[model samples]
Target: MDQTTSWGILAALAALIGGFLWEGGHWEGLIEKTALLIVFGGTFAAVAVSYPASRLRQIPESLKTVFRPAAPDVPARIDELVELATIARREGVLALENKIADHPDAFIRNGLQIVVDGTDPELSRQILEFEIDAVEQRMENQSKIFESAGGYAPTMGIIGTVMGLIHVLSNLADPGSLGPAIAVAFTATLYGVASANILYLPVASKIRIRAADSVQFMEMMLEGILAIQAGENPALVRKKLTAFMHTEEMSFARKKEESEDGTETEQTQTKRA
Candidate 1:
């Protein structure tokens, strides 16, 4: 599970709720079933109408992606690619064929298959690049689904508020109910804005980030495959792929270095003692 995404959502809700309570607002004021039904139900209906049935079918998977993002292990992939490059350099490109079955990622496997088949390098790169583009486009479309929901949610909330007002206006003879009715009407607006910012828009942004990371990882693999097919040295292959490591991976590398340094220092002191 993506703890950052999960904790971020919880923190946002806690801040909002805590601030409201601090301001002497009652929790009951935020609980309007009619407003919730209108904003959420209407937002869903709008999103369903906006996207195709096939796209709609992916909502569950999309939601899961936002909550449980699959981050690629960049260092591990680099090591694997360097190993493959070494194997190809020593034993020939055909050696990769045996390793392809053991590979987990289809992208890496396909790239290796092309190399093992003696496909022209330029054509292989084009095919792999095209696949990467298609995957990116598909992920972009999926993110847009949530983006569309974010766009529509606030408008739906306004519509719900308007509808509530109309009902309140129609029953204006009950002066005692005016305050509560107005509060209920405004709850729809709160729901719409909060859900859009907290859920839909954030999910879209997370998906986009994941898509970019995935593309970078695939590109690194493609580069490794091409390098191996061209018989690049394993050290050079490792050098090229390390460029794909993001800041987080760099930080991890730094921490690992520090740990090793500490271990070496402790061993030296122990030897002296």
Candidate 2:
């Protein structure tokens, strides 16, 4: 789970609510149900109108992805690929067919399968690149939904405030009630702006960040697949995969590989408020 992300969101809420309370504001003032309905319900209605059901269906999964992104085990992946390289060198490329079947990850499995089928390297790269692009485009679309919601929410809030103001004005004879009514009206604005900044836009950003990480991981897998197809040395394949890793990841992969054989093998493997 993304503790930092969860904690950041909590912090944002705590600070906002804490500051409000510090200023002597009561919880009742901020708990205007009508304002919430306008900001949240209207925002959802607008987003529903903007996107198709198929796309909207992705919201649950998108939120899941944002909060619990599947971080690739880079070092373990490098070790796996290097092990594949060793097998191919020892047993020939065709020997990988059975091993590839048991692999659950369709991305790398399909790419390696293509290579095993003797497809041209460039074509394999193109196909995998196209897959990456498709995945990226889908991710882009998903994030845009939240982004669009963020854009719409503030407007919905303003509209709610206007509606509330209109209601307040219609009761002009109740001079004593004007202040509280006006306060109630303005709560819509607060809900709108706050949800936009702290929820919608931030969720959209987290989704994009996680998507980029996933795409890069797939790219790394593609490189390893190609190296294996080319019959590169196991250590060299590990090295190529390691190119995608950070300094710390490089050390982890190296240590893990060495621990396996007592010999060094080189390989390497978001926030919302």
Candidate 3:
């Protein structure tokens, strides 16, 4: 999976155990199942109660956000479209039919297919923009779900803590049981704080970043499609699309140039991240 996520979690757990060992010189099953059940179960139940079924179902994707790679750069994408445009100009848009299957980036492929099918430029732009908006909206919803869950987690933790305290107070006559009961009571709060900070919030941030990157990619494709429709020169279109590439994307182009002695610089890879 994602090494960052894996390593961060492993390191956190190792540090936690190491701290405990350093303090007490031994390890015990310090975690309490009942506390976890109350905190985690209650927080999840709260999310289910708060969000719609469709939104709740999208939570898994937010978790996957941690491991998912970022979207490919827009400049690199422009390069690919330039190649396709060159081919279409020399031959015809119909030649793209076979190339569509070989192409990467579903958005570009779909737009190319539309042009090849002779859709009017205005209608094609409208449809592509609509699809982009839909995808962006879905991603935003997923991010908001985690944000909402993060908002709810600490409250659930407090609830769990209070519930534990209630148990501890109930057993006031039994001094021998007070220590473990108090520790268990506070454990729920730890779960809530930890889950929200390390899990939900970070995932939501990643989703937002990915959504923005994807939007940029879509914007580039829109420009490429419109230029293609107007029968602009491929070199000109490449120049225009270059404006959309992030700084990091341009670095990939530099490496691509070095790999093939700049001759194959025109034939950039069509793959999208």
Candidate 4:
């Protein structure tokens, strides 16, 4: 489960409950099924009207992303790339032909296959970057789908609230019913605000984060592939690949120090020569 998504939902619920309690509220007489049905139904209807059928089907999966984010294994995969490159350099790229089919990651596997076929590094980079860009564009659209729903949610909520008020106001001749009717009318607004904040906005934000991470990781893969094709040493490749894992502050600092030391050593050797 995605910790952020789970924690976000839990926190939202906690805050709502705490706020209610702090306001001397009780659960009794607060059940507003009509309000819920109207707001939720209206919001979804509006969304359906706005988005295409394929995107409509994806709503559930998008929501699931909030709690079930796919783990980004790109950083760890860098080491595997280093190993594969070393093997290719030692035994020749042809030796990797059989293993290409066995690679679970289609991206790395395809790149290896292309390398074995003696594809130009420039061509390979272009193709791979194109594929990555396509994927990113698709993700962007999905994120926007949720964001679009968020834009509609609050307005739909208000629409529901208005509908409820219309019914309530028409029956104002009955003085005893005003309190219950007014409470029910307000529930739609509450539902709208809550769903927008807890669900739509957060999902969009998570998608954006996921998109950025994915793009960075793919760019790192591109670098590694090019380095492999250029016959760079595996250890040097590993050091370079560490740049993709800038999420680790310690790794960034270590890489910086190592780079500085490597330059110093090169300068010293040149002076001695």
Against the hidden reference, what TM-scores do the models get? 0.90, 0.93, 0.82, 0.87
Overall lDDT per candidate, in order of appearance: 0.90, 0.90, 0.79, 0.79
At residue 1, candidate 4 shows an lDDT of 86
What are the per-residue Cα lDDT tens digits for candidate 2 across 83-186? 98898889888989988788988987898789789999999999999999999999999999999999999999999999999999998997999999999999
Minimal lDDT window, size 10, model 3: 264-273
Task: Summarize candidate 3's per-residue lDDT along 1-273 as a digit string, tens digits.
Answer: 668777876787687778877887454445778767877788788878888998888777766765766546555566678877888888878877887777867887888889889999899999999989998999999888888778888888888889999989987898998987888788888788878887777778878887887888888889998787677888678767867776777677556546644555545543321
Using TM-score as the measure, the top candidate is 2
Note the residue pairs that clash in candidate 1: none
Q: Between 2 and 3, whose lDDT is larger?
A: 2
Query: Candidate 2 at 125: error in angstroms?
Result: 0.7
Between candidates 1 and 2, the one scoring higher on TM-score is: 2
Q: Put down candidate 4 lDDT per residue, 1-273, tens digits, no spaces.
A: 888688878899889978887898877535578877877787778878888998778667766655677766654677687887798779877777887888877777878778878998889999899979987887787888878778777887798789988999898899999997878788788888888888887888888787787788888887887887888887788778777775674365466558867998999999999
**Candidate 3 wrong stretches, greater than 4 Å:** 15-17, 25-29, 70-79, 101-104, 254-273
User: Roughly what TM-score does model 4 have, to 2 decimal places?
Assistant: 0.87
| Full candidate order by TM-score, most accurate first | 2, 1, 4, 3
